[model samples]
Target: MNVLLIGSGGREHALAWKLSRSPLLGQLFIWPGNPGTASLGENIPLPVDDHRAVSDLIHQKGIGMVICGPEAPLADGLMDFLADRHPDLALIGPGRSGARLESSKEFAKEFMLRHGIPTARYRSFGSREAEEAISFARSLGLPAVIKADGLAAGKGVVIAQTREETETEIRAMLEGRFGQASERLVIEEFLSGIEFSVFVLTNGDQYILLPEAKDYKRIGEGDTGPNTGGMGSVSPVPFADAALMDKVRDRIIEPTLRGLKQDGIPYRGFIFFGLIRVQGDPFVIEYNCRMGDPETESVMIRLESDLLQHCLDCHQNELNPGSVRVSSSHAATICLVSGGYPGDFEKGKKIEALPQTQPEEHIFFSGVSSKDGQLVTSGGRVFAVSCLGQDQLAALDQANRLADLIQFEGKYFRRDIGFDLK
Candidate 1:
């Protein structure tokens, strides 16, 4: 069937690549897609936020389904709009009420608390409650966590090692450091452990689990600097064995899905469980309304199923968990960013020397566009390089090789993608 894929990023590119291989697919269209996705399908220049324009295009192209790749459009109620405008059109992703789990940290905390989901303890405060928030952080002691209640493009959460840093971050968040997105703050007790991502394709009550992945969020090597959207990711996390997954399904994922059904929240799309493994048990750190970038790149690389068919099953609430398939091989994805990324950075520099892909290696573009018929950087993150191999280290090695081959004026990438695990 004809499909409309939303957003423009590496995640969308990977999904486009996989969807293009589906025999069930007739035509694929990407909204404002990048150079990478442009190769796989038609890239329409329509803005995703313009619901009317999007509906117009859907009607024109006879698009049967829309797969949302980013959180913003979903959180904006794009799915709800489509459901109302075209009742027959298959839609992926959640509406605003369900997206609240990701858009509002305070709302997510409340949901977790109400559902008995294992998560870190948190207290919400508004702009006027800066002093109260600080007092709460002080009581939590050193290494306290301060989070902006709204989406900040993955940079809203900060782990403060000292009381001074904690106070400053809390005040900054409530004082509009991130503008309206940070008008409120969620002070959470810090939990130290290895963090990973869990993706679920759900239709309110029933769901299908995707491969678990671990991503490096900090921009620097060894995870030392400020957080970026993501640095790199590896699928089939070395530490999340069967036992841990069992705990995650029972203690976290199951409860979360049940809670959503119980609360009457309309949802049908990807749920990203940002989880941390503390002392061999899983505890949720956060949630996202859609698939996580960089993680999607690696997960797609390792998936051995017809993603389009699975997406259709999920949309129709006819998914059979036994039908899902994943490759035995490991996959890794490393991001290429502008030199001054996670801060101020320049764009539009001509990109060059991208290598040809082999059998298992792939390059997916994100913040890149064709400028005067030549590829050029368009955002902080330029693209991603991914590969499959016999093992995790081998996959990382091949992905890093591809990362090195791609060239731009100020291209920067972390060489040690899976370093901590090594």
Candidate 2:
């Protein structure tokens, strides 16, 4: 089957790599893909918002399936547009209603509450409710979490440590700190726990859980400083044992699926559950309509199933518990970023060179572009170095080593990826 993957990031590159290996695949096409993805398939320079152009190309290329790798396209009703215009085009993504789980934090929290899913206490507020939002934050106390109600490229959340800080953040958000994304806000009570990511492939009621992963979201070492998209990730999370996984499935995942079904929402795609374990119990932190970046680089490395087959199963509404297969081997990914990432940074810096990688190690580009015959930085996150190993320690070691090999003027990466598991 011919597939058209949307997005230009580490997650899409990893998906492109895995999907390329499937024998069921004929040709792969990436829309606005990076250099890493360009190596695996034909990269198309189509704008994501140009639905007419995308539709025309799909028909022209006879693309069998459309796999959306990021949340923005999903939130923009890309699936609905395709479904309405070209009903025969197999798509691996939820429509706009289902995408609300990620596009709007307020909607997700309310949906969780309505469905009795385990999550932190949160109150959604419009800009006019700034005073109420502040009062709610004070009630929750310091270390409160202030999140922009709409998507803000993963940087919409702020973990304020004091009442004053919380108030200030609330005002900033309401006053257009994150533009229209912050017109509304959701204030959450800080839940102390370690965070991890859970991905599931679902076709409405039927679903298959993929490998679990934990990603470091902070921009600095020791998990200090502001949050970035993701600095690093590890699959087969050491702390997510079977017992805790049972709780997560029953208390969080099951309830979420049931809620979606009961709400009459049509869903057929990846559901990324942002979870936090508090005293061995899992609570949902957020939901993503698509796979998580950096996490995908790690999780895809450990996926043993044919990626194309799984997507087909979901599209045909045949997804089952046994449809997914994952390797027991550990996987790790270290994200190399431009210096001063998650903040201001320069782009188009020449990439002097990249070291040769072992068979077990791989480099997935995120924010890189080929200029004239040389690669250069184009975004904050530059590349994700991924490696598979017999154990988590070995995987981290290999990934860290390979990450250090990539050379660029402002290259920087956290040396302590997956350190907590150690």
Candidate 3:
């Protein structure tokens, strides 16, 4: 069937790449896609924010499914608009009510507390309550998790390790560190644990688990410094054995699905459980209405099933657990970014030294534009080089080596992508 994929990032590139290989796929169209996606499908320039225009094109092109790859569009009620216009259409993201889980940190916190989902204790404060928020932050002590209540790309969160840092972050957020996104803030207690992600495709009640992954968010090595979109990721997480997964499924995943249903919110799309394992127990860190970026790049590589078929099953409310498949091998993704990324940086740099990847290695584009017949950097992150191997060490080793081969001016990447696992 003809499919329309929204967004232009590494996550979308990974999805498009996997979807292109499906035998069930017909015409695949990526809206405002990057160069990598262009090689796999027709890249259409559509005004996604203009919901009517997008829906009109979907009808014009007879697209059977619409897959949203990012959180912004989903938070903007894109799915609600399309579902309203085309009730029978397959939409791969949730509507506005469901999107609040990611769009508004306050809403998610309330939902978790109300539904008895395992999560950190948090309190929300409006812009006027900066002092009140600061007082709450002190109560949580140092290493407080301060989050912008609204969408701020993937960089809305701050884990302040010091009291000064905590107060500064809270004040900055209240005073508009992220514009309107930070007008309201959610101050959460810092949970000490190793963080990971769990992905699933669901029709509210029934669901199929995808590969779990862990992404390095900090721009610097050793997980220091500020968070960028994502520096790198590893899939089929080594620590996510059967015991922990069972706790995650029962304590977090099942409760989440039940809560959504009890709230009477209709959902049919990817639900990314940003979780942390604390002393062998699983606790939710956040919920993303869509898949995580660098994580998606690695997770998609481990999905052995036909991507299109699984999505269709969810849309048709026929998700069969028997049809789901995941690779036993490890997968790794190294996100090559502009040198001064997570900060001011120049774009339009020439990219060269492109390598002919082996069967296990692949490069997925994130942010680049074709200028004067050359691929140039257009955004902070440039490309995601991924590799599959028998173990985490081999997968990350191969991915790191390939990451070095693809060169660009001001290119930067972390060599210790999956090192934490080791």
Q: Write the per-residue lDDT of candidate 1 for residues 19-38, one digit (tens) a residue.
A: 99999999999997888888
lDDT tens per residue, model 2, 95-115? 999999999999999999999
| lDDT ranking from best candidate downward | 2, 3, 1
Tens-digit per-residue lDDT, 1-422, candidate 3? 99999989899999999999999999999997888899999998766798888898889989999999988888899999999899789999999999999998899999999999999999999989989999999987888889999988877888888989988999998899899999999999889999999998999989999999999998988988888989999988889999999998898888999999999999999999999999999999999999998999998988999989999998999998789888888999999999899899999999985899887798999988899889899999999999999999999899989988888989999988877888
- Name the Cα RMSD for model 2: 1.0
Global local distance difference test of model 2: 0.91
What's model 1's lDDT at 286? 93
TM-score of 2: 0.98
List clashing residue pairs in candidate 3.
none
C-alpha RMSD between model 3 and the true structure: 1.2
